[model samples]
Target: MLTRHFLALLFLLAFAPPGTCGPVKILMLGTSLTQGYGLPPGVEIPALLQAKLKAAGVDSKVINAGVSGDTSTDAASRLDWSLADHPDAAIVEVGSNDALRGIPPAETERSISTILAKLEAQHVPTLLLGMKAPRNLGSAYVRSFDAIYPRLAKRYGTMLYPFLLEGVVLNPKLNQADGMHPNPAGAKIIAEHIFPYAKALVRKARVRRTAK
Candidate 1:
């Protein structure tokens, strides 16, 4: 009887469903737009994402790895350290600063590509948020910069959320006084837009965990 019970217990443990062991960890790697900028604590994109996951009954933790003023290059530098937490998935949101700085689009592409490659090696599912260069940068620069995200996302086989700001950018009502960075309400809109993709990532993570 004791031997039979032991075997059953082992089988149960081995087949336990994903998320039963613990909450899935999601890494949000990005810039000030991701950091929540002037917004107070608990109002950033990561926080908003966490709340949504919980409300939807998905057991998950969103790690805020955002750094204000960070460009794609900066994000690339810290990716290995961020991956130290061993996130089941990640959201890449950098590049706005790179555009603002007029960094060559190729350089921005290389940095973002590096980040995606590292994430792929770890087998972590990723959702990349794209950014468009300011119109003032002229048609040529805009064209080059905007092309980077989709190209890299395709190359890396990661999910893509075209235009991070989407409905929030250029609307005075949505931006902070600096005409950049979303206000609280604006942040909510972003959270709503990204929730679907993030949820999909969570599901993918759970599926991968179950398969393992």
Candidate 2:
């Protein structure tokens, strides 16, 4: 029985997923979503993403540079400071706050475009996570804001994840009491959905040296 148990344990560990190789710094710049407003410490989006990467044998060190309620303009102003870590790659999640605040789409586009340009200047690979305007914002606003992401992605030649809150938004069970931010479980789903893109960034990071 002891020998059988030992073999079973060995088999389990063989498939048990190895931790990160070293530490490939990945910066997550955004607002409450990345800040993990309603989630617990280890359950935040960045942390959860780190865990997912590690499970896939990636050594991702996700730096949470999120400041809740920060708009695209706000993120633009703080871009330099936020890049202090000199991450190998970045995931940009700003602009949603701007949309919520009813900022003009052109203004939002300009700020986000500038931000992407700065990252490109640093030679840091980036993944832009998009957000759609609420339907109540009206069709015109929706068209403008919704088009901002693809437009920016094209202009900057960066990878774009269509929507950040793909399967979680508006799902009460996946959201917290306020229904804006996600709960822990919801955070996990986000991490999973974004993992493929984030993993590509990791691979890019591995080949490239740290950003100056």
Which one is best on lDDT? 1
The 10 consecutive residues of candidate 1 with the worst lDDT sum are 13-22
Clash count, candidate 1: 0
All models: lDDT? 0.93, 0.89
Model 2: colliding residue pairs: none
- Compared with the true structure, model 1 gives a TM-score of 0.92
TM-score, every prediction: 0.92, 0.87
The lDDT of model 2 is 0.89
Name the runs in model 2 displaced over 4 angstroms. Answer: 1-22, 210-212
Q: Whose TM-score is greatest here?
A: 1
| TM-score of candidate 2 relative to the true fold | 0.87
- Stretches off by above 4 angstroms in model 1 are 1-11, 14-20
